[model samples]
Target: MHAGTTVELLCRLETEPTPDGGRAVVVVEVSDHHPARAVRARQASSADETRGHGLQLVGAVAESWGITYRRDLKTVWFRLLAGPHDRVYGPPARFSQDDPDLQRDLRAAELLAPAPVRRSPARRSDADWINHGALSFLAEASDLLSGQLDEEQVALLAAQLVVPRLADWCAVWLYDGGSRDSSGAPPRLARVWHSSEGRIDALRMALEKDPPVLPVPGPQRDGAGAAVPWPWPQEPSGYGPGGAALACRLLAGGRDQGALLIGRAGLMRFPDEVVGLIEDLTRRVARAVATARAYRNQERISQVLQRRLLPRGPATVPGLESSVVYEPREGAWAGGDFWDLFDAGDGRWCFALGDVCGSGPEAAAVTGLARPVLRLLARDGYGVGEVLDRLNKTMAREATDSVAAVAAAVAAAGPGPDAAVELRAEAEQTRFLSLLYGEIVPHADGTAGARCTLASAGHPLPLVLGAGGGVRVAAAPQMLLGVVEDTSYESESFDLAPGETLLCVTDGVTERRCGHRLFDDDDGLAGHLTACTGLGATAVAEHIRRAVHAFAATPPDDDLALLVLQATERR
Candidate 1:
């Protein structure tokens, strides 16, 4: 989409033997960075009809057409019955606008295109009305499918998208291995939809006994735009008019994602245009299925790592109450942010709240190494500053190892096309950390109050809430960890007077934005805490969490976490 961007282009034409003349299938593929979506047909204003005629034009002339997507490539293909072989396709001897045949073809193209091609107001029905508005159906289908992240939801939506419109009933069968040919498992019937609600179960049960086995798209196989005839079920009365039934493979990312089946009771055979439309819908469904599967796999890993990183509950302090609120922003789990609270023995309790500079598996690796090392140092009797100083060294060492490993990988990639891209991607991921680490010691009475020692390293300063509703900063900020080695850190020491509260929050809370205004604009966090002076630690945590969410109409875009420590007398 930008100047100097390199994209591979490919074109292939294949001929298929047919009872009626020959058939030609043309496939065009191009490299793409973004996921595939339905072709968009924008509303036109003036008489000029060529402006936004993207895939709409293809939909007009092609007898059957569909789209397929791989990880880095997208293929849009169309099929048409071959004409007389002797017909010459050379350049016209003299081009003229007055040609009658040319004029006829132009009219046909216009008439075949969806209603928006001929009229400005083809918005005859609501977008959800299937098959009536072709443009709206495609645009809405893409919007709905592209946003789904569950495989089952994708299957359900596919079945509902076709039934009661193009067909009397539709059913979806998904391969657990994403390959119907897999030796491990068989295709599973995921969803079934029908115009009559009661027929859904009967249809599903009948279909389960006979799963369709379609050929994988290949040189010998028919084009992806084509569907094979499937047997009609007549076991139950009224199941079919014996009209027509067809099934197509849901193929994407170079494998069969699933199969789609649909049947109409009255039609002897579906029109080519209708078949092409269903083919396009199948591709979109396949792409959505692939995306949902990828996300589900990642979610499984993220939740597992997140559980290991965060504690179930903060350790109990003798004279102080502690509560924590942690929420990784939607889809940003696995090292976006982490917090820990544990007892280090010797009447000392250790607490930490931190954010990684990057995200994903790389950041998870850093956080994974950081959390356990923090516990090890605290248990070894390292004071607050001492623990941070040692952890910084360990993080620096790990960062060096990571950089070296990536450099080695780049070298192994050589000067090939992927080398530079790999290096740039690796360079953008950092191991630096912003952290708030502290030690808590209850007073000798074990209920009067506690002594607090804490340090902020390139992190938001902690706030101390006084008994009389006043607030102030607790620790001064310093350099971030994993960036520089042997950095001497300083900890602020203070008495946690009875009934006072300490609030330490990650940047997710302080930097929450609503337009140009931030949640912590003009000391807003302190102001919010000022109102929460007399509440318990849990209440203060909940109050602050709610305030963060209420600060903006949208949810926070970054991982949010906070720690609340309240000093109490033996309660």
Candidate 2:
């Protein structure tokens, strides 16, 4: 029988015995004896004839055959090779040491063993490339400013750094701040140069469809075209061509600025390393754009505030043509020089010039408060002395630490020829202003005479320029305002010829410098003023304005205010 048939027969007779006059019996064993031994054993059996067929079947299935003799009985045995299901049988106890075929088969099985696992070549190489590219791109992108990288440059870098490095096409899209679509929404689209023409057309068509389809997760590719999901949900779609792609949202300060899309043409799509690089680059771009926008906004706001706080037109009075100039200090502080002309009623004009002690928003706030208060007091018919007293009272009541030096002058223009007499009497009683209060009134035959009642409060003296270019500083100076509530001011009278000029300025002018040299103390500013005396009050004011600016070579360190008043007589 064939080995397979014989094995089946032996399985059926596993518990049965041969057809002999003896007890039914089956014996199983293991050995290295060849098939010839089984045949020889059968010939020697006394019951050979009766069990011949069974013996042949057993010999074919058995791994070896044998017999054992005892004192009273004999036993026959057959060895069976273990089958796949025969777990009950243990391994063979012994095999022929000289059996060459058995040794050869065992060695062959050992030689066919499987190898140990390792990383794929593609994976390792790609990792190395990604590391090197990320470092290089970071170094280069960090140096690019918003001003330097326009939209086109940004798109190009996206492709060069991400597309080829990741073996994909790249695209970026920006949200439009203006120009909405048919839905009354702003237009958002892929930036030019980043999207192919066909993909761009598709995007336009998709946007036109009703209830536009938003980006969804996973590989969204129609052939080579793919649209990556952007962080800015409102931004228009950016499309590229590839099998797999990744989309990253560009954000700055918690705001969605734009999106970056990278596509891969092959199975080797963007892994974690590539995605990380794209994210880093996108973050940098967002930061640069945000910084630029913030800077622009700050500049615009500063410009508007400066124009609003500074003076505009010249002050107009009948006999007095006044011009004023104000310069703010440099650094973080806003300058606080303020000047104004208020109609004090009864044919009189009240003018005051003052400077707050410090700079910046706080000083500017004080200035804003002071200008209107002075106007209100002057309009209420308060004399120069009373105005100073009220101003000091307000400051003290408010507990304001800010101090100021102010000079005010009030003059009646339409009184009779004895107006000079009336002004001198009023000046003697006016004692509060650390100021020079002056009045110009008609004399006999309608000629004008000027009476200047002066006081000081740690402030600079006023400068007077005569009609024929004569110059004289105020002969007396007194204490500043706000220091003494009951201090007495002095009165002095001077003749005002036609075409005379009076100049009142704050310390900003005299205290300025020309590249390290003082302009006023060294006589530089005085000489410039004298040489330019032919100019009218407005012109003189402008000349001084230019001189001070040129001297400082920058914005003034304190607020500078100049008021030039030139007398114009009726021809």
Q: Tell me the tens digit of each residue's lDDT in model 1 across 1-571.
A: 2223345667777787689956776655545444434434445335544443334455455554445444444445555445766799997687689977667535433554563453234322223233545665677678768878888989987886786446778988888864554435668899888765546667887888888777666755433635777777765543565677889888765567778999887667776766777888888998888778766655565567677787878888888888998888876756468899999999899899998887765566567778999999999998999999999998887764554453444343222213342434544446788999999888876559889999999899999999999998999989999878979999989999999999999999999999999999999999999999789999999999999999988878888899999998775
TM match of model 1 to true structure = 0.68
Clashing pairs in 2: 63-79, 224-241, 334-360, 456-478, 456-479, 457-479, 457-480, 458-480
Candidate 2 residue lDDT tens string, 1-571 = 2121221122222433336622323446322222112232223334213332433344334433433322322234554433434456766667697877666533321332221121122133556766645575576556533433244444444444443345434555554431111124422444422222224444444433422233323333311122244222122443433356566654554444455555554443556676666667777765554454444333343354355555566445556667777666554434556666645565656666666555443345455566667678767876665666666665444314322211111111111112232223322222222333443333436455333433344556677777677777753676555456565545445655566777777788888866767768856555666766668887998888888888855677666778777776644
Q: Which residue pairs clash in candidate 1?
A: 447-569, 447-570
- The candidate 2 region of ten consecutive residues with least summed lDDT is 405-414
Candidate 2 at 263: error in angstroms?
7.6
The list of candidate 1 runs beyond 4 A from truth reads 1-140, 177-183, 217-226, 234-238, 266-271, 330-335, 359-363, 399-427, 444-447
Residue 1 shift from truth in candidate 2, angstroms:
98
lDDT of model number 2: 0.50
Best by lDDT: 1
Q: In model 1, what is the error at residue 2, expressed in angstroms?
A: 47
What count of clashes does model 1 give?
2
TM-scores for all candidates? 0.68, 0.50
